[model samples]
Target: MSPSSEEKNMKKWKTPLWAAFAAALVVLLSGVAALIYLDELYPVGLGPRQPIPFSHRVHAGVKTISCFMCHSEAPRSSRAGIPPLETCLLCHSRIIRTYPYIARLRGDAALNRPVIWERVNWLPEFVYFDHSMHIQRGIDCGHCHGDVSRMDRVVKARKFQMGFCIQCHRYNRATHDCYTCHR
Candidate 1:
């Protein structure tokens, strides 16, 4: 065989080295992904990371700011819409104008950017929940959200499992006709 063709044939010969490398990479990546998923499912001493560190302990607890003030849509809408940066700026514009976090908020506000807060509690897409209905029923936010006044970093206090909702409904004497939530 010609020297160049022989060299090309040698290069084309299959080896286990590439296969081993790919297998090792897959195992390593899978382990990392498992750790991340497990951490999210069961956080030991912390909650999920947010883009900003907004504290409920300081805002709702110490400051005694009502939940309605920030979650304005709770009273009238099906979902409680997260307060926009403009709403936060109402107080932050003057309260902590020099703090690094507030300063970042100000910058975003200047550019008309909104802060995206993470939702700690979750409900399945098949289940329909109405914040206004619950609010009208005189159920305080603490019933579902736990005492936010005591929490700095929000964490899920309890799983929103079917049994949890059923129990609450039974105690409150609310309907349990499946359609009440499963709609």
Candidate 2:
């Protein structure tokens, strides 16, 4: 082939190559921007609005209530069950019995109805997280829960992603096998 023809072929190839690189860069940047936007819209800092505005700071921090007081089953069961309305009424029945929110708690207790509290820290259904196992292993609640005594409203402190769990398991020399968590 002629030198000029070769040069023309090279130029044609370079043009498409540069165009493809530019397109790929745009796509990468677009994905990053979309992630940032979604992160802002649904932040980990935001907790769900509970049926009653219960403050962890006031109860756990100020009153010095132990974590086990409200989550009575954490040490014994896989689930840290929400405190029954009767448990709340044990305090509210005498202390703030006239307050509207406390009144609601009182009414619910009277009828033996459970309060539908919104769960804040949630794991995917595939993963099996046992609170009792962690408690028995001497893992502090703060490690996963992040200073509940300090938080007025409980927010997700750590992203609880697979990488986070795997890192913790590997560091602690716990099982990092897929079945350990996935099952």
Candidate 3:
């Protein structure tokens, strides 16, 4: 065969290989970036909308109420208990009755309709996070939940990723076993 023809053949063979490599690289980079984004959303909790604009800073810090007041059973159970209507009414039924939002809450309670608070900062369904255990073990709520008592809107300030949690565990000389977080 002519040398020119051989060179042309080689170029043709290499062209597809290069194209494939480029395509694979694009796919790989895209996947990596997507994973990074998902990691940011690790402890996926409530997204944007919350039922009532409850301010943690006002309720917990200004009022100096304990975390367990709203999450009454947090130290005793896996789930952080949502405050019942009566719980909120305990203060709101009289004190904040003039506030438009509090009036609405009072009306809802009177109607026997519960305020459906959108839970933010939730772990994956497969992952089990026990607030009781964490609280009893002296894991401050601020560690994983950021400074809730300082937040007005309660947006997620921490990336609840497995790696993030594990890093905390490592720093504190705690266990990072799969069983520790995941069910």
Candidate 4:
């Protein structure tokens, strides 16, 4: 082909190539923006909907129930165990047994089925956090969990990220070794 014809062919291909590249870039950016929007709508901090709405403000703040009353194992075990249905029934059986949500609790208790409570704060599987250790070290629940007594729906108080935990460890002069948190 002649030089001028080759140049014309190259110009034609360049226009379409640039247009295709721009189109792909727009699509990629749109997808990223959509994911960010969705995340904002349903943030990690916003607590999950439970099977039954249990208010920490009412129980812990208003009623003045001790944290240990519900989480009986916080001080003694690695896992701060979720209270069984019987714990709810202890007061609920007499107080609001007629309420529909309470009635569901009653039904679960009667059938010996556990109420599957949604977990709010969770670390990665590789990260090991002992509730007892923190509790023993005089770390109040609020330190990590935020003001749970004020929250009706217990949302994730803080981002349980590595940097956050590391900062805490450094401040408290706790073991800052990688193995201290990561197993």
lDDT value, residue 46 of candidate 4: 51
Lowest summed lDDT window (length 10), candidate 4: 40-49
lDDT of 1 at 138: 99
Residue-by-residue lDDT tens digits, candidate 3, 1-183: 567987988877775778899999999989888877887634444345667788888999899899888888899999987889889999887796899889888889889998888777788899888889889889888887777777777878787888887887888888878987887
Candidate 1 residue lDDT tens string, 18-118: 89899999999898888878886455645566788988899999999999999999999989888889899899889979999989999999999877877
Residue 168 lDDT in candidate 4 = 91
Off by over 4 Å in 1: 1-45
Q: Residues 58-109, candidate 2: write the lDDT tens digits.
A: 9999999999999999999999999888788788889977899999888888
Clashes of 3: 3
Model 4, span 1-183: residue lDDT tens = 456987888877776768899999999989888888888644555577899999999999999999999999999998999999999999998998799999999999999999898999888899999999999999999999999888888999899998899899889999988887788
- Which wins on lDDT, candidate 2 or candidate 4? 4
RMSD of 3: 12.0
Question: Each prediction's TM-score against the native?
Answer: 0.74, 0.73, 0.70, 0.74
Report per-prediction Cα RMSD to one decimal.
Answer: 10.2, 12.3, 12.0, 10.3
Can you list the residue pairs that collide in candidate 3?
Answer: 45-121, 45-122, 46-120
TM-score of 2: 0.73
